[model samples]
Target: MNRPQYILLPVSPIFIAISLIAAFLLNLMPWGQFIAAPDFVALVLVFWGVHQPRRVGIGTAFCLGLLMDVHDATLLGENALAYTLLSYCAIMMHRRVLWFRISTQAMHVLPLLLLAQAVQLLVRFIVSGKFPGWFYFVESFVSALLWPLITVLLLAPQRRAVDKDHTRPI
Candidate 1:
């Protein structure tokens, strides 16, 4: 059965908005060093990169990172540069990533997440003239570990909708 294309699939804007909001919330949350959460915005960008490259590319990543920088009151362009680099890496590996299973994609995403965090750390150090401590790296690890879960949870609704459409008559 041919599927109808008008099944109200959630678009890029929704994802972008949710990501930005999550980033802001994560930044605002007072974790107090127990468990350093991953950068929500970065994770979101990766998800979009893997799933919707045409709509959420490096430009979008850079913009979102800039917003993060502004929201967190960090050095201007620090997150932006990191995010831009991450986005580029994601796009470069987009085809391969799409071919991988979700679990495999999480493994693949680990390095990109780490890379983004490392770049951001470097930028922050350059701007602030000091290191942010080892805890900063925790975000990268956490993000990598959370990638599969996040991908599944966030994308499940869309997948279900698509499945429903396919099973239904046109």
Candidate 2:
């Protein structure tokens, strides 16, 4: 059986802010040291960049990236540049991406995530002359794997009908 297409409600600005803050908070956890630990901020930024381009665009991504750069104590603008680029790419491809299934969308997003990671990696290399190893790219792969779950979760609020359907049982 085919699933019904949802007519999504308008997303709330407050919800967007909360989600972005929550993602940043998640990154603040100590587990971020793990090579496989996904970048929560990047994931959420990409989501909003695609779903609500006008509401969350390059400036939001840049600001969040700066916050991450400060929090990570790396060179200023490292995460900012990466996130800004990711946001731009997401906005460019949003219409094409919205046409695909969740899994396919994740596939499309993997490269963008990797590109962002590559940007960070390149900046690190230029500034410190260090290669973080092949494992450094694993986080983007993991984030891509998580795209479906994140999409479902972040889009939940907008998925609800404006008014409850009380015609039938609860």
Candidate 3:
């Protein structure tokens, strides 16, 4: 069965910024110690990196990662390194990922999320000589699982109305 594709409106920079801030705030909540809590900032970074590579590239990811590092009080550049690589991987696969539905996009994102988490883990181990164990990876899995929900919520503002206007360009 073929599904009709709806054209999306151009996304606003302000909305993108707000979403990033909201994701950061979500991460800042008291759930940081919970093993099952997803990394909201990482998910949003991947989403934007894939959807608007030019607007949200490695630099943006790195900056956000640094903020996360400071917030977590971990070694500087731990998150920055992980997020920079995550943005790179997302940007590299953006073209292919766009062809799939949102559900499939989550599958595509899982490995990247895993890899980002691995990088962070490795950095932490190298610095502190400690491994947080398997539970450390739960965040990536949870983040991947939340991808579809995040996609819908973030894209809602950019979706055009059902009615079409001929004079307007999509």
Judging by TM-score against the true structure, name the best candidate: 2
Q: Summing lDDT over every window of 10 consecutive residues in candidate 1, give the lowest-scoring window.
A: 1-10
lDDT of 1 by residue, 79-136 (tens): 8988998888988898998766677888899899889888888877777789978877
Least lDDT summed over 10 consecutive residues: which range in candidate 2? 161-170
Which runs of model 1 end up more than 4 angstroms from their true locations? 1-16, 32-34, 161-170
Q: Write the per-residue lDDT of candidate 3 for residues 60-159, one digit (tens) a residue.
A: 8999999999999999999999999999999999999989998899999999999999999998898889988897888888898999999989999878
After TM-score superposition, the amount by which residue 78's alpha carbon in candidate 3 deviates from its true location, in angstroms, is 0.3
Looking at candidate 3, the ten consecutive residues that score lowest on lDDT are: 161-170
* Alpha-carbon runs more than 4 Å astray in model 2: 166-170
In terms of lDDT, model 1 sits at 0.78
* Root-mean-square deviation of every model: 4.7, 2.0, 2.6
Clashes of 1: 0
Candidate 1 residue 100 C-alpha distance from true site, Å = 2.0
Model 3 misplaced regions, further than 4 Å? 162-170
- Global lDDT of model 2: 0.93
Best by lDDT: 2
Per-model TM-score, in order, reads: 0.79, 0.95, 0.92
